[model samples]
Target chain A: MELIDNVSVAKKANVYFDGKCISHSLTLADGTKKSVGVILPSTLTFNTGAPEIMELVAGECRITLKGESEAKAYKAGESFNVPGDSSFQIEVTDTLHYVCHFG
Target chain B: MELIDNVSVAKKANVYFDGKCISHSLTLADGTKKSVGVILPSTLTFNTGAPEIMELVAGECRITLKGESEAKAYKAGESFNVPGDSSFQIEVTDTLHYVCHFG
Candidate 1:
């Protein structure tokens, strides 16, 4: 869906990589935590504490998980999984809009 | 309150000035429209079709409304208004977090 409904959104944003990445935290009705965010065209490494599902809403990116040599390209309407306590390098060719599900 | 509850948030972001400013559209249950956004440290001009109340959640900036000669400084917990069909110039010294209420 294009919209996430009935959630509480934090007014303050999570800014990272010098504002190359920006996200707003959300708490769903059942207490599920998620974030809607944007990543401008940039190559950045992100470390994860909780396993995450990066669901793309728009734009394009290439992702390389830690210890992986080959990069996988992902675009709008695609999703990628990253392991907990691991990291990934993402090269964004276009501005990326995504919802991150964390647990 | 620090959070806006029971609202629907658009997954896609509104990226402006090449990502210097970013915001997400939100719809309240009563159909009131609002946005939560971030503006990185930069000077930018914004035009308004609807009158706006920009409520600052954090950071600092100086604002000059359309046809105004003097700029006003605002910080966290402050707010500023801009009339419809007018514009404003904002010089952000620190990254800005805000909620825009439009009518």
Candidate 2:
């Protein structure tokens, strides 16, 4: 879906990597927390505290999970799973719009 | 309040100025529309279509409304208004987090 209905959203944005990545925090009606964000064309590494499912809504990127050698390309309508307490390297060829589901 | 409760948020982000500014569109339960966004350190001009009241959540900037000579300094907890069909120039020294309330 293009929207998350009936949710509460934080006003302040979360800026990371000097603004290469930006996200807004969201809490669902049932208290489920999620984030919608964008990653500009750049290479960056992200660490996960909670297991995360990155759902791509737009753009493209190559992702390599921690301990993996091959970088797999993912685009809009695709998703990837990242284990908790792990990390991943991403090479974004296009600006990426994604919904991050934690835990 | 720190959050906008009981709203619907778009999954995709609105990326502008080559990613210098990023935002997510939100719709209140009653159908009022708004956006939460961030502006990195930069000087930029923005033209408004609907009359807007920009509420600052964090960071600082100097804003010069269209047809105005002086730029006013604004920071967190402050807000500024922009007329419809008009524009404004903004110089953000620190990273800025804002919520744009539109007509």
True contacts kept of each: 0.90, 0.91
Listed per candidate, the RMSD to the true structure in angstroms reads: 0.9, 0.9
Q: What lDDT does candidate 2 reach at residue A68?
A: 100
Model 1: native contacts recovered, as a fraction: 0.90
Cα miss at A64, model 1 (Å)? 0.2
| Model 2 lDDT tens row, A20-95 | 9999999998889999999999999999999999999999999999999999999999999999999999999999
Error (Å) of candidate 1 at residue A59 is 0.6
How far out, in Å, is residue B12 in model 1? 0.2
| Model 1 lDDT tens row, B4-37 | 9999999999999999999999999999999999
The CAPRI quality class of candidate 1 comes to medium
Q: Which candidate number would show the highest lDDT if scored against the true structure?
A: 1
